[model samples]
Target: MFKRVLIANRGEIAVRIIRACRNLGISPVAVYSEVDAKALHVRLADEAVLLGPPAPGESYLDIERLIDAAKQTGCEAVHPGYGFLAERAAFARAVIEAGLTWVGPPPEVIDLLGDKVRSRIAMEKAGVPVTPGFSTEEPDMETFEREAVKIGFPLLIKAAAGGGGKGMRVVNELKGVREAVEGAMREAQGAFGDSRVFIEKWVQKPRHVEFQIFADTHGNIVHLFERECSIQRRHQKVVEETPSVAVTPELRKQMGDAAVATARASGYVNAGTVEFLLDKDGQFYFLEVNTRIQVEHPVTEEVVGVDLVAEQFRIAAGEKLSWTQEELSQRGHAIEARIYAEDPAGGFLPAAGPLLYLEEPRGPGIRVDSGVVQGVDVPIHYDPIMAKVIAYGPDRETATARMIKALEHYVALGVPTTASFLRDVLASKPFRDGETQTDFIELHFKEWKGETDQDRQIALVAAAILPNGVKTLAQNGGEQQSWRQPTPWETLGSWRIGGNS
Candidate 1:
């Protein structure tokens, strides 16, 4: 075990790594940017180091600064928790060269699997199903259109060097292929400076599923089942769950075997996720591999009853996997809803303001992983994700009910959140019946407004009793509370909302 470990990240993932380190009796070192001086992760760590400016490039992503911080803090290991430099193979190599343990996969695996094109080639070698695609030779539209025709219509022009829908576009028709390909190429070039674009057959109405795998230097490897992450907006997964309704036990085995094969093909180790796209006919094709612990990993942990981060630690210390595939079992269903400070109705514009009040839900089956707190200033400098609310139950129905209850209990002020919208999603027939797809948010829940008067009766009750009753009620307009602020719900008691603004 490492005497000390440096967390080279920020926000909820930083807090997550700190907790894991503490549980393992390892002193955790937290490195923060100027904007995160008072961050919750920094507050919880055994020691804190100031990296640089508020921008990620100047701080969290600055390899030299993070390495110096780890060395100065006497950390024997560096844990890149998810985002920032977590998936960067160069950072892993730097840590190893600096004589510090990299609590992640080997650099070779990161470099190989992190690149989408190389991963695709490796997956094909491993016998995993892959979509047909053509890698761009240069930032030229002529070459792009010719390849698109070869791959057929309805092709996806994607960034070869990045993910998260940053440099991706879809062309359903031939006329749009030229423009779409050029646009994707420019965007990819600007974002990744690689200019390389790839064309692939775009599957229609596919369910995004991914398996979590862990391996160690001792050559032992195992998977922690799968997560149905099809519920997304703009290609970014917004909602995720364990033991997908789309995957059966037999199907899971097939996907799990392919995931392991993909990992082993790249000589992967530590923790990673092998993503796949399952079509309507139960056929799944390899998508890409995330070379780091994912943001939605908690839902898998909730069901699998094992700590993946701790496993990363053990693996980094030269220990084998603690369990085999047969020993691992998902106990229940788990669902995660990512709450962002963005208006779903207003073009999903990011919300930035002081978080005047934040009251997260808590209970037997609920878990909250948050970044901001009461009185915290949510700026426009970064991703607007406020927190993640997860609910666990013995089955899917129970989990849905618990998630609804938890979302109802959560209350925030100042910046607008999709909490109310999320509540509506849970209550909708499609979501309840598990008819979710990648386009579910836009197809059904995109324009969700909120609940009615009957919905705020308890909010009125909470307003009637909460310590800041008057302020809470006044800010949100309860049944009998004062209406001072011009909130969206201000005139709910007076039957007014400006005819849908």
Candidate 2:
């Protein structure tokens, strides 16, 4: 085991990695930008190094600075926790060349799988089912137009080198193919530094399911079941659950087999997610591989009783997988709701302000993986995700009920969040019936105004309690005297409001 490991990321994932390192008796080092000097992850690590300014290019994305920090901290390994440089192949190579263990798959595998076109070809050769589409190393306007006709209308023009909805366009007809391709390529180049694009047939009303697969240098590999990530907005997952209503026992076995095959075909090691789109007809097609620990991995952990981050450490230390395919089984249903610092009503616009008041739901089944605290400033320089709340139960109904209650109790004032929105989603009839699809939000919540009667009641409670002192003023008509109340600052008087405080 490594004496120390450096977390080359920030926010909740960094804090998560630190905890795992501590559990393994390894000293954890944290790297942060200037704005994150007082962040929770920084406070949790045994040691921390300042990278640079708030800009990601100068800070978290700087491979050289990250490598230097790891070496200077005497860390034997570097763990890129999910975002920033997690999927960047060059960063992994840099760490390996620096004589430090990289807690992920080989750089060559990352590079190969990063290219959507190349990965599709590889999966096809490995006998995994792939979506019908046209892919080429060199594509032009004429070729794209021709391919669009063959692939039919309502196809996706996607970036070859990136996901997360970046550089992606859905075209309904051939007239929009050229413009969409040009737009997708430009956005792809800007986001991923690669202009390559590909075309794929769009499966209507598909459920997004992904399998958790892990491997080791000892040549042992297994899939840890699947996560249902169909509830999404703008191609990003909002709520994720395990034991999908769409996946039966036989279907889970099929998808799990394909997921493991994907890992074996790519020579993939460590933890990764193989995503698939399950059509209404009970068929599944490969989507892409996320070459890192996922944001919703806790759902799988909660059900499978595994610490995935710790397993990553063991794999990097040249240990075999602790469990085999036969030994791994999901004991219960788990659902995870991502809490972001964004306004769901205001078109999900990212919000930043002081976390004046905060409270996390706690119970037998609730788990909150949070990074922000009360009285801290929510910065706008990075992803607006503040935390993730996961709930588990013996069955889906119980899990759903727990999740709804947990969301109802979660409180964060001074900045808008998706808690209420997620609660509404979970309580809706369609969600309860498990009719979720990739376009679930658009189909059901296209007009979500966000402020319900409950919100108004909470506002009234705040107004009543926040008036520390009042003065009366007489009107000309001598009506009951009007009252002027003190401000929030005067009422609170530097007292922090939170579960911890």
Which is the leading candidate under TM-score?
2
Best by lDDT: 2
Instruction: Report how far residue 178 has shifted in candidate 1, in Å.
Output: 3.2
Tens-digit per-residue lDDT, 56-85, candidate 2:
999999999999999877789999988788
Could you tell me which 10 consecutive residues in candidate 2 have the lowest summed lDDT? 474-483
Instruction: Give the per-residue lDDT of model 1 (tens digit) for 1-501.
Output: 898999998878888888889899998888877666656776777778888788778988899999998887788999998767887888999999999999898988887876788888889988999988887445466777777888897889888877878689988887998777678778877666666778889988889999999887877778899999988877888789998999999999999999999888988889999999999999999999888888899999899998888888989988879899899999999999989888876767788876767899999889998876665567666778888999999999999999999998889887888887888888789888888888798889766665566859898887667756456533564542234453432112212113323
Screening candidate 2 with a backbone cut-off below 3 angstroms (N, C-alpha, C), the clashing residue pairs are none
TM-score of every candidate: 0.89, 0.92
What overall lDDT goes with each candidate model? 0.83, 0.89
> Which sections of candidate 1 miss by over 4 Å?
450-501
lDDT of 2: 0.89
What is candidate 2's CA lDDT for residue 213?
96
